[model samples]
Target chain A: MVEITVKVVGQRTRRLKVDPGTTIAELLRRVGQNRETVVVRLNGRIVAEEERLKEGDLIEVIPVVTGG
Target chain B: MLRCSFCGRRAVYHRRYAGVFLCDRCLIKSVERRFRRAINENKLILPGERVAVAVSGGKDSVACMHLLHDYCRGKRCELVAITIDEGIKGYRDESLPIARENAEMLGVEHHVVSFREAFGATLDEMVKVAAQRSTGLNPCTYCGVLRRSLLNQAARELGADRLATGHNLDDETQAIMLNYIRADLSRLYRLGPGYSPRQGFVPRIKPLREIPEKEVALFALLKGIKVHLAVCPYASGIHMEVRDFLNSLESNHPNSKFMILRMFDEIKPHLEAAVPGFEARGCESCGEPTSSTLCKSCELLQGLGLMRRRKNLIFVEPS
Candidate 1:
């Protein structure tokens, strides 16, 4: 099992245990986020949703919607 | 690991619609290039024009401002920023500083017009009073009409040749689909690259119309452009549903947003021919251009008991 941290910027952060080599897409689905609505960063670098997350990966999800 | 299509750097974005994997540098470059292409293709701007950009301090708007700033650097076009504060507590107030910061960072002259200043009531107060009076109107109805009016007025007062907005492909597609769903031909005609010039109205141009919303967000993120990334608390309704539907549709059918935009463009000329342009007259109450007797903002304010019209004079009651 791989343990990783997920942070939805401006919302919440949580540590989760998942199977080894979890993709960002799977993490987003687990966290109840739509791929269309947010951008993902793994370990401080922007990454594709299909990019696999490794152990100790710090994934940050930044929502794209904004109010003016 | 997927390699960037343009350069073999680490891929950061996988554009499913185009089947391209792009690194941060290539993504930023392509987004900027697409922005410039939209401007050039549509003739959205010209040399030596003073442009007022509607910056909400959001990803799309701030990215629009940033790209426009870079595009206008050598073209002798002046870029200014205008932010309309709808006075939504915790929403507008939070974004106000981000907008200011972005404009200051770009050294662009920024102007903030607020609902309180223009209509004598903040949106929060208006929403409260509206609820108490059973107005049955959503907060978006009030905010949209008022904000558009204020932005235009501010742009015209700034002597801007054109007012630029950061409406990406997703926004363009949603608006097109929504208008089609409502069969609102008049509004459908208005959803082009540039709005038709009218008296007392600054021509509005959208340069980011070709880029996708995700690309705009990614561009802003990669470029280190600061933006307020909070969704509006009152962003529910049919529009949200349409946005979600479109997003889902696009997810399943990649390039659907671009297809919708392209389809609209193809039919826009026909739509324009069928539906004649609106004849706007100065509002009797405030002299702002309106199709009806009173402008929408004035009508809303009057309906909410915040403004009263008497003998060609309108008096706003301070909230």
Candidate 2:
């Protein structure tokens, strides 16, 4: 299992271990996070929902809706 | 003409059982058909591309998603439904379940993205902040900018080739008026049924651009699509003023909306020539594709003390 870091916007960052073949959407949903509340960028590139993420991937999930 | 039970307006016919009566002026068939043709004419969607429909759980958006899903059946193109949760206390929560249920019933892929986690604050918070900074300006101005930016980014992440919105004829007409009121010539030129893809920006297409507001409601009812019938609370006082103005115009002229659209068509050539196409550039602060050195989304974040403000200022919209 590869270690991955998930940095959610407005929330603290967390690390997780997963297989390299996991889809981004699946990983997001697995983390008990609503897929609708955030957008994920893997290593500076926008990660598509169908994208299979690799081990040691640093992902930033940014929320699209803003208040102010 | 049959009078409407709710609004008490004279309609051409009564739908019976549904109890909603519509006049030729109210029926949206002609407008819907015209909009369909306009979308086809503009070549907004390719044969096999996937389109993400921005569903707002309203009559217009729901009808748009359903129509596009049905229209693309068995075709190479597929339809997906997406909703943006603005994090308004009671508004977004109520609409989300309805949007999800509609997507499930339609057998299309659906996704929701929220504002609280994304912006470090909810819309209610943002409105409070903005109000504290400046009085009189509505929260909708910020909300519209934020929602548009989010939808585009979310659609891109979803691998959608095109983004479809349910902006009907009335919306389009009001937008025209708003642009005119602002004297924003560039935006007025860009307002229409189609938007082409730019370097970093995904293309957005409006399939319901020609459909009237009333017809969209009728279509939703006839299609049996579950839609949130409540008006937005945030839309109660000020924004309703603009809508009431438009409604008055429609009531007096009946075909006023269509006439306004026709005016757009007449001015299309001039508008295209006068307005420059959208250019995508990396945001100086966040590297997002923004019209300016920094994107509006980033700007709002900076204003909210979330993202750092970019020092390099390129293009700024005149307020």
Candidate 3:
């Protein structure tokens, strides 16, 4: 089984490993993320929630922020 | 891979309205350039002026502070951070530290003003009281009005020439549409990027108004700026719906958001004569500038019985 790293790029970078080929949605769920509240970047590129991960892929989950 | 239109590098963002794909460097440059252009085109700030950026510790505000700091380099203008702690226990308490952290990182002076100190109660306490009294208004209504008022007051007291907020394109367009739906012409006129010098009120400037919210988020991440990711608990209601609706529409129509903002801009000038204007007055309670008998903050506090609470309530019970 291949492993991918999920790095939450928010207040603190919380890292976790998950099985490869995981959908961004599943990755968010495994990482305890709310899909509606964040933007997901797979490796260096922003991707859709349904995008699948590959082995050794780095995911950056950033919170969606608006106005002051 | 979508290549950046400017440079032959892998694109990090696809700006739909502009129909352009940009690499990280190009995107950041574009955002910065546009930010400066927004300020320069509108004459938002003059040389030798101080700008107080309202930092919420969120990516938008933190990123804004950093950008403004960069823009202030080698110039007579200065940038400072002003964070208002609304006393939202789980929400704001978590974000306040990051605000200070960002300010420190950017080497800008940071000042935190709290509702507890300024209004004699935290938002948590105020919300609890409002809930107890069955107040129909949402927390955001009171929070937004009071926060804006306090920001203006604090900025003015800090000797700032302008108070800058981190309102991006999505927020601006969503606000414009919401005002249209509610037929709030006056607020609609106030939704643009820069405010003119009004009597007794420090002008508010929004440099990020031309940038998309997602791009701003990506820009912050690319720059490694630390920001609070959690959304406010009271961010629901009609505003959220309007935001979502606009997002969906923009996803299909691409540039629909920009079109709406442009339309609003086109119509805003004509609205000046159409909408009835009010002469500014001073609040009877606090002497802050107001359009009515009492300023919004005082009126809100009066409704919440804070005016009464602010009085000396130290009673010696039959000692």
RMSD of each: 3.9, 20.0, 6.4
lDDT of candidates 1 onward, in order: 0.86, 0.70, 0.80
What's the TM for chain B in candidate 3? 0.94
List the candidate 1 regions with Cα displacement exceeding 4 Å.
Answer: B308-319
The number of the candidate with the highest lDDT is 1
Best by TM-score: 1
Better of 1 and 3 by TM-score: 1
Q: Per-residue lDDT of B81-176 in model 2, one digit per residue for the tens?
A: 889888887777887888888889889888787777566678898888877776455777668987887788778777889999988776788788
For model 2, the stretches where C-alpha displacement exceeds 4 angstroms are A1-68, B1-32, B135-137, B236-239, B276-278, B308-319
TM-score of chain B of each: 0.95, 0.84, 0.94
Q: What is the DockQ of each candidate?
A: 0.56, 0.01, 0.20
Number of residue pairs clashing in candidate 2, backbone atoms closer than 3 angstroms, sequence gap of 3 or more or interchain: 8
- Residues B1-319, candidate 1: write the lDDT tens digits: 6679888999998899999899999999999899898889888899999999999878889899999999999799999899988888888898889999999998998888778777788889999999999999999899888889888888888789999999988888888988889999888888988995578899999898888888889998888888888889889888998998888888778988888888888887777568866688999888888878998888999889875222221223478
In the range A1-68, model 3's lDDT, one tens digit per residue, is 55776677654655556666667778777777655446777786765566667777788877684442
Clashing pairs in 1: none
Per-model TM-score on C-alpha atoms:
0.93, 0.71, 0.85
Error of 1 at B14 (Å): 0.4
